[model samples]
Target: MPVPRNSKTTGSKQLRPGKAGAVENARPEKEESCQAKRSPSSPQGAPKKRSAFGDLTNAHKNQAGLRKKDATKAGPRKAQKGTAALGVLKNNEINLKKATRKTPPDEASAEPKLVPKNDPVLEEPAPVQAPAIEDIDKEQLGDAYASAEYAKEIFNYMKEREEKFLLPNYMEKQYDISRDMRAILVDWMVEVQENFELNHETLYLAVKLVDHYLVEVVSMRDKLQLIGSTAILIASKFEERCPPCVDDFLYICDDAYKREELIAMEMSILRTLKFDINIPIPYRFLRRFAKLLPLPWSQCAHASMETLTLARFICEMTLPEYDYVQESASKLAASCLLLALKMKSLGGWSPTLEYYSGYSSHELHPLVKRLNFLLTYQHDDKLKAVRTKYSHRVFFEVAKSAPMDMLKLEVALKS
Candidate 1:
């Protein structure tokens, strides 16, 4: 059995019935203090002790927050994949743009830029066509030694070079030396060629050097032999494979000039000529014309060689003659060949000769006539070195061959 007591006197302060009911429905104060003590983020002082009820209460609240965040993250799977793919594509596009900015375009693979129609660079000039000439070197095309492919071009270039080196009547410009002295010097140079066994080109170029040097400088008669010997030395160096030494030229000059004098003269001659001693010679032109003849008349090959020798003899005769210094090597060679052909009774200047020599029979008439006159009146004994050289059996005695008659030579030239 339980005893009942009055509410106001139950060993405590009494509250009205409504107030006590409100207190019974409210949260406990101890629970609120425990939560505040566990939380340092609270406005109260530093946390003291953790109560078990406080731990359980915080765990329940954390679980509710986590569930809300999980629901937000549960988006469509396709949308997430699409966003990632779009971001990758944007990065790739940016990288490609950077690469394009760094690398230059390849020339061979790139398109050619279009040139404006009115540009002067686009307006190409027409090529100047060379004249049509006979193909004389066609047979020698297989002979690499012949240089057949560039023969025409080579000769054409030589002809063009002739105009640049035109010699004037420089004899009148000198005071001490005369044309006759010049002739005597040339005669001696021929003897040097024979003695040294030097090439005929060396002799010709030596003579040319003397004449060219005489044109620019005045020399006394005493030093004439020195000048001639030095000229030979210079030409030998230019044209010979095994040119004689400076001592050899001094010995050849009969020790008349000192070694230093000859060397000084050589330097002076080269300086006066500007070191351009590659003057075209008649021998080269004559040989080229001779080649053209044998092709047309292969049967007369032996006779042609003799005739070439005769032509060379005639050409050599004019080297000492001051009157022919102004003559271009090509034209002089052509006239000499014409005279030889006339003397041999070979067909007068054919189309092949005319094309290669660049001289028609009529155009060469005056020079040919003069060349015949030169052979006709060969009475100069002092200048007989060329004649004596060609008269040998080794040269086929072409010098002993008789000259063509005057009237017959005229007829040949006219034809």
Candidate 2:
């Protein structure tokens, strides 16, 4: 049937089956087109067109490249971890190789090198050797005394102890005693010592006790004799094997002190000195050095005895002189021995003497000259007890020896 041109039913009547299917498809296409137009109103629609400048911008290009790079990197992450571990191992291998490589000789020679060869520039130093026991014993004995390996040790020990008992200055100031009065006391003590036949060590120690006691205590002149007597009494007991009885001391002092007074002074001195009575004296050192004198025994026995007597006289003379309190016993001994050698026309000071005495002749010259002056110049007749003691024949009459001339002493010293 023919359809009317403007009627929808007529148009439907003119449609074939194929045409009808096409019409239905056409309706869906129109619906889709309407939906596409509505989608532009939403935010998630098709991209807007870019400007010319935006297409040339580097930020978008860089972002695109980064995205490509991140995509590529994502696939190799596990392999990249293995490769990083390989690189660290390679670095460790290189460090070990460097550490194990031997240094070249040219580089080693740049530093100080110890070589066993005898080349003067590279020779090693020799090791030090300790002194032999025999050498030490010889040195300790000083070629004179009995061989005592520990003599040097003993001397050093005594030297350390000497500092403790060093007599202080102003010793006489603490007492009513003058230097002259002390000298008189020492002279009388010497006489008493001889009368009692006491050892010379006892006499020296007694003087030390008196001096040390006087330094700590004040006393009247009347009590000075008592103090001296008590000192002698105490020293005798300590240094003597068979000390005299108390009655003997009283008899020597002509009954000047009773037994009780003697005992009291002894206790007072011991208290003041704290019972430390062992003190070094010049007499001991003098005797020790005198034994070292190289005398010509072939000529006569009197030669050795005379030299020792002169040296002893000089040492005893120093004891009464208060100015010599500071002089060490060893030094005084050396000086007196040297002067005795010179006075007797024996050989002058030598290296052997220096080694034993521990002092050089140059160091001993001044002391030697002072001793000569002491012998030659009569300063005090009253202080001549030491001289008178030696003037007798029993003491070798060393005090009767010819006076030493200054010119002769000067010549001897220069040589």
Candidate 3:
């Protein structure tokens, strides 16, 4: 009466629960068995074994708790973000308010004001004064003549060289032309000068060239007008910015001479002069002397201009007088300027003028008398060109001014 195999299997399966309970009660014994097995395979100093499943379980629990704490902090973080956005908006509003504030128009347009504590109003800076001529330092004044430097030496040398250009003989004796003929030529040249609006320097230079040519080369009296015309043409080319062409010069001369003859005369004059046309004339020295006068600073420019015009008139008068040819241009200029000042009742020649001009009152007095004689007595019908030219108001009516008396001139010169 043995049991069936199937029944036996079912009975063993039912006893498994009891077996599991017993294994649980024998845990220390199982651990000891496992240690024994591990000890055999491991080295003697190996660490004791840990429960890996227990450590994994504790790590999972800690992770879950940390996730809960992060969820709890999320509300406060959102509140802080909202507050920071509000602060940024408030700062933008403040900036807008500052930008909209009104600025005063005057303050906006004006430069930044620098207000002093004692004086609120801004004062203008005082004007600087020029030094008086008497108090001016010689070195600081930088006057080319007063400095007594190389300019003086060069000028003296030039004076010596210019003296060679003077024509000592009569224009009529040198050439076949009379003094009246020379005066007529000069008068025509003046009209030509006025027509061309040429400078005074050009007029003076033309006259000088004509005189020099007459002295050097003897020409027939019939060709005198051609000589004057050619001299003016040469002078125009030398001095003017837009010089009249040969055709224009011919027209001014009423086409008196042919172009070939005029050209031939120009060549002859230039050849005879050796092209030395740089003759010193009184006009330049007159201008320089007028500027050197120590007039009142306020009136210096106007006074100098008036004096210069009168001096120029006087110099032009000297051009027609053959006797004046012996005097140097510098001496004539000094005398003319001195006479002009005396006539205008300005101070006479001073030491300063003497120092700069290298001529004293005594030296210029005789020349002054000679100039006076020419200005007064030499104005006959034939020699009235310069007087008529200077009588116009454009020349400041210099010819009409009372002639300087001899006694008063002497007194002023001595003073």
Candidate 4:
């Protein structure tokens, strides 16, 4: 309370509760508080959770920006999934998010809501009654066999026409597989089939494309084989996994199918398919429907191979679109095995189809049986001649001549 040096020291510099410097500093703090305390309606920088009725336009935009930030913060994989899901949500008509809101039934409806708790209406619809397979015969299938038979005829004619005339013309037009080089190209295609386990569809498509390219483009002679081999290589890649590498194929051919051949063929074929390698094959569909019917593995494998064999037949033909691979496969399998049965004069139903076929544990499809019989009578010698013409073809080889085991498996399943 006492000034040590002089009383003037205390009076001259008297302290003040509110100094100008303090007031100036306080102004910024007050402004910050006011800024903090403003309106509740103003959106903070934080992202609001997306809701059912959120503004789609703005929501998408904000979500997109947040995604970029999150991607950088989280990782790339999440960002990719988010982007894919975004596309699916925007365009996926069938997979839209389920509506959360549920309406009360009593509010409105033409029909009564709850068939009273104890009423007959409350009873569940009588258990669905599907007839046993024995009761549901092929006659009930109505012309299914006929359709398959007709389809086969069309495909057979198509192959013959495509190969003898159309293929050469196509080669002349598309890839210029000159007459001399055509043989080599054909050989390479066969090699590809053996090497890649490629179905007939891919093989034929590649061959057709190569032929078309040769006919249309006037490439140098030295590069002709390359064009064919490469077409097959890439076609394999598009159609299957574990496709051989350019170098591996080069080695496989003992360097006959060289690197240049592969590279050239890739471009030539890509151009021919118009870059659309998404052509459908029958295997996928056969698997799906076969699951519903319950055919055995022996039958399935036989069916698979037979269907594969049919792909060869179809590849050589031009009657129907290749997109019908599944339909053709199913029919071919049912038919080929059916024929095998008729030749042996096998008969009777199996439990597998005693339910469906009503025959003892032995019969396969009747139509197939009829087809076999008809084929035997119709092509006693013609089969050899047709095979002779198409023997050198890439996708025309028959994998198995007899499918007895598959038939037995089919019969066993019925039991």
Models 1 onward score TM values of 0.66, 0.64, 0.62, 0.35
Please provide, for model 1 over 11-111, each residue's C-alpha lDDT reduced to its tens digit, 9 standing for 90 to 100. Answer: 33332111000011111222222211222232323223332222435788888999998877776676799798778768799875665566646742353
lDDT of 2 by residue, 199-254 (tens): 66788889889888887888888898889888998987887655777776676566
Worst 10 residues of 4 by lDDT: 18-27
| Model 1 Cα RMSD, 1 decimal | 50.4
Per-residue lDDT, model 3, residue 65, is 96
For candidate 2, the per-residue lDDT at 142 reads 32
For residue 368, model 1's alpha carbon misses the true position, in angstroms, by: 0.3
Rank candidates, lDDT, best first.
1, 2, 3, 4
Task: Quantify all predictions' global Cα lDDT against the true fold.
Answer: 0.73, 0.68, 0.66, 0.41
Q: How close is candidate 4 to the true structure, as a TM-score?
A: 0.35
Q: RMSD in angstroms, all models?
A: 50.4, 52.9, 53.0, 33.7
Q: Per-residue lDDT of 190-305 in model 4, one digit per residue for the tens?
A: 54453343444456556655655655567776666566567666666665434556774564444665566577667766776577544333222222222223334344544443
**Candidate number achieving the greatest lDDT relative to the actual structure:** 1
Off by over 4 Å in 2: 1-147, 296-300
lDDT, model 2, position 305: 68
- lDDT by residue (342-387, candidate 3, tens digit) is 7777877776677657898889988888777777666668556677
lDDT at residue 362 of model 3 (Cα atoms): 88
